[model samples]
Target chain A: MAQTNLLSPPSTISPPTALQLSQKAPRIIANPPTSSLPWPLSLLFSAETPEAWVTHENALYACLRTHDDAAARQLLDRLSARFGESNERIITLRGIYEEATAKNNGELEVVFKKYEDILKQDPTNFGVRKRRVAVLKSLGRTSDAITALTMLVESSPTDLEAWAELGEMYAKVGEWARAIWCAEEVLLVMPNSWSAHAHLATLHYLSTQSSPHLAPLNLSLKNFARSIELNDSYLRGYYGLKLVCQKLIPLLSESSSVSKRNQDEDGPPPNLETVKKLEELATSKLAEIVRRYQPGTKEWQGYDGAEVIAARELLNRDANTER
Target chain B: MTLLQTAPKKQTLAQIRQQRSLVRGINLRTNANTLSPSSFQARKAYMVSAYQEGKFLADPEGRGKPRPNPMSDPAAMEGMMGMMKGNMAMMVPQTLIMGWINAFFSGFVIMKLPFPLTPQFKSMLQSGVGTRDLDVRWVSSLSWYFLTLFGLQPVYNFILGSNNAANQVTQQMGQVNPGAGLMGPEQDPDKLFLNEAENLEVLEHRWILDGVEDRLLARTAG
Candidate 1:
């Protein structure tokens, strides 16, 4: 159990405030702001020893861990100022994280520019690239995110995560075939990738456009089931399996009825109406799975939990209309 | 042979399960480092907490990772032994009461003191005589008939059980299996055992239980 300290902050125990510490700092080498600095140099301060820098890093990490936004913001401010405005990529990224979560669009735009600058300087920083992808996706720049991720995938085929991200971006943009292809690519690299299988299943089961996709849907469900076989706690794979199963149920029902007639009938032509209904039902079920595992109220903090709940509601509305 | 040397001790199932749980947790944290920053942070915090709690030794700047040895830290070994001793001490009261109760119910009696007695005295006297006469005689007969049962039995069992538990903990450590717990069903028993063997060199150095630790480990293998 965590011990809670109820005492007041210690009085008269003054740690050097930022201004006092900065006064003892060395002069900055007057270089153009656009020039790329060694990544670590961008983290320097006037009199701060490596030990103090480490302590600051540890403090920032602790704030992030405990979900203390205010402390995290203060640390980010200090780091950004020390590194100078143009080169504080990490600090700027932290700012973006803070702003994105807070839904401060103006703040998000400011920090996003910094991220863009970081990417321009070194596009291969996979960590920054992934975070940038998330920011872009959240900001509704789906096309741009996809282009960036596509480039990332071309360069790093071994990174299944990049493939997964591309697959998700494709889905957001309604490029179902590309999404399926990306998901499949991930499974090729990591045969037991539950997320990839889940994405593929979602695309096939939820899309109403074609019949060729159903084969991959079955395959995706099987992969998902295999992932579940490996780790039962994988709620994502379970949600995917549930969506596929919901879709399969109606198709199976239609087939069983047709089989009784003993007639060579091409399966009931895709009824757009029924297909749309199945899509809504599958989507709703996926949301319900997420909601059941959603962490409680105070800990909610604008998480996947809310997105999951909203997605479920959207599916329910669609399903209700179809019914 | 002495009581401790008489039989090769075995690891109990509960000890195995507990160790597996801890090892599995450590593995989950290790593997989480690859996919998520949150997991990396959590693992770092967990390590820090374990160090603070004295469950693990402090990590020096560059002198290799601190391996937990049950034997090297005399204080830790003493603490575990102390717990076993405390548990053994508890058995004394349990046995004494159980022995007295068994004797009373078995229709044994001391010399009947035939004098008119108060009801209170009668009950108290009956209990005392029952314990002394019935228990003492029954125990004497039992010692001759079933010679193996002794006071040291509980103590030895506690020692072996605790040692087995500690060994299992060493097996489930984070350094041993980095991603074991996240997907429990996928965990490899053979791999876990192999890792445990590799860790044993360090584990043995911290042997918490004097002679019984290895003996119990061998029995557990069986």
Candidate 2:
């Protein structure tokens, strides 16, 4: 009227429809209310929305940070119903399930079964097999443990950890040959693996003692030396080598003496250098054994440990005699 | 025109060698006896008795009972004594010979006897009898079994004191080979304290299957 033109009065503009209002409408209905969720749905729906999903995620995270598993699970469940079991929800739920099982206060088999079902469906999802293998080992199903480890080794042959695990499983079952093979496989992958050499050395020593041959002894000695070379702190391998050398050296010394006595018509004692090398090996290995496994603490207690004590006693006597 | 006394031909080395050959056959027979199972058991029993029990057999029953002295047969005894005295005389030192000669010359004569002073020495030489002393045999057998279990068979084998490992090694020789064997899982000492350690809750109501109690805690706290 003032303009008298009625210029269509700016033609009464209509507000945009709800669907046309925000592209984040789906994000709004799915979020829960928590301290972590700082934004209201109405605010989230407004034109000036400041990251609704992130704000809600932070709120839920804060509740979990406070050790509120119930509140956390509640929010997670509510979100899962809306969002379905996403990877994040699966992981968090699995953590809660494992914690419950570990406490012995909950039904473990049922939860583990559920976890297995999930893993069966996904298969390559995360490190589920490793976790399952660990759980099986804890349950004392050694055969099953071995089978699981076999599968892991087959699937992940290049995985050093998997190789170690397979070796350990074989060792636990008294499959020395297989254990040594697995350990050597690991050594192939990780050339300087002290543990692998230790495993091989132990197998050689135990399995060879009943035989008339020296090949087993030689191989065992080599692996023991290799293990010591890799890690001098591995007292078990060092002492084990010493124990073997203790038995072998006397036999070799006797053989050498016999050879020397027989050599009146010969050029030289048969492989005299071999005897010298064995003696040198024994000396060094015994030294390593003493350095690594000295008996102040009860660390050396059982037969193997007691052998270390015996070695020390013998060495001390030798030193005294030398003085 | 004296009756021709034929010069006794000196026994040549070949004839002496022939005579020595007879003793080798006796040695072979003794060696065969030593290889018998009873001989092995006797040796093992002896070793165990000597080393572990601090006992030695003065007269083991398995050994045959000794005969009474051959010296009781004076003709045979005199012949044996003459042989011994003749051998002793040649090898004996002059000073030792004089002492012996003086002793023999005097009334305190040291006469050589055909039989040994040790009674039934040959009879005591018989190897193990199948059955005799129950307690001694039982203890020996029991100790042998236990020591094998404790891995003493190797030491016994090395000393050539026992034959138990013989059959065992032969039986396993086909399958036995060298390599590291599987080891049993090493139990961590820390595992013993696991039950004693208080459970540290990473999340509560994790025990509650349904979120009902977890929600309740929140509601109660709120």
True contacts kept of each: 0.00, 0.00
Give the runs in model 1 whose Cα sits over 4 Å from its true position: A1-70, A77-112, A131-135, A208-214, A233-243, A249-323, B1-222
TM-score, chain B, model 1, is 0.24
TM-score of 1: 0.35
Model 1 chain B, poorest ten-residue lDDT window?
A: B204-213
Q: Which CAPRI category fits model 2?
A: incorrect
lDDT of 1 by residue, A103-205 (tens): 5656666657766787677654566667777677777788888887876665454466787888877877788767766665555455445555555556656
Q: Clash pairs of candidate 1?
A: B23-B172, B27-B178, B70-B206, B71-B206, B71-B207, B72-B206
Best TM-score among the predictions, by candidate number: 2
- Computed on alpha carbons, the lDDT of every model, listed in order, comes to 0.47, 0.45
Question: For residue B37, what is the lDDT in candidate 2?
Answer: 29
lDDT of 2 by residue, A1-323 (tens): 12211122222212222112222223433544323434444333433223443433333443434444454455555555644564644554444435433545245555567558866665544356666676677667778878977776544444567768877888777776777666655554555566666777787677666663354555565566556655644555556665566556665566765654544311232243443444455456566556755554444232255566776776676578669
Compared with the real two-chain complex, what DockQ does model 2 have?
A: 0.00
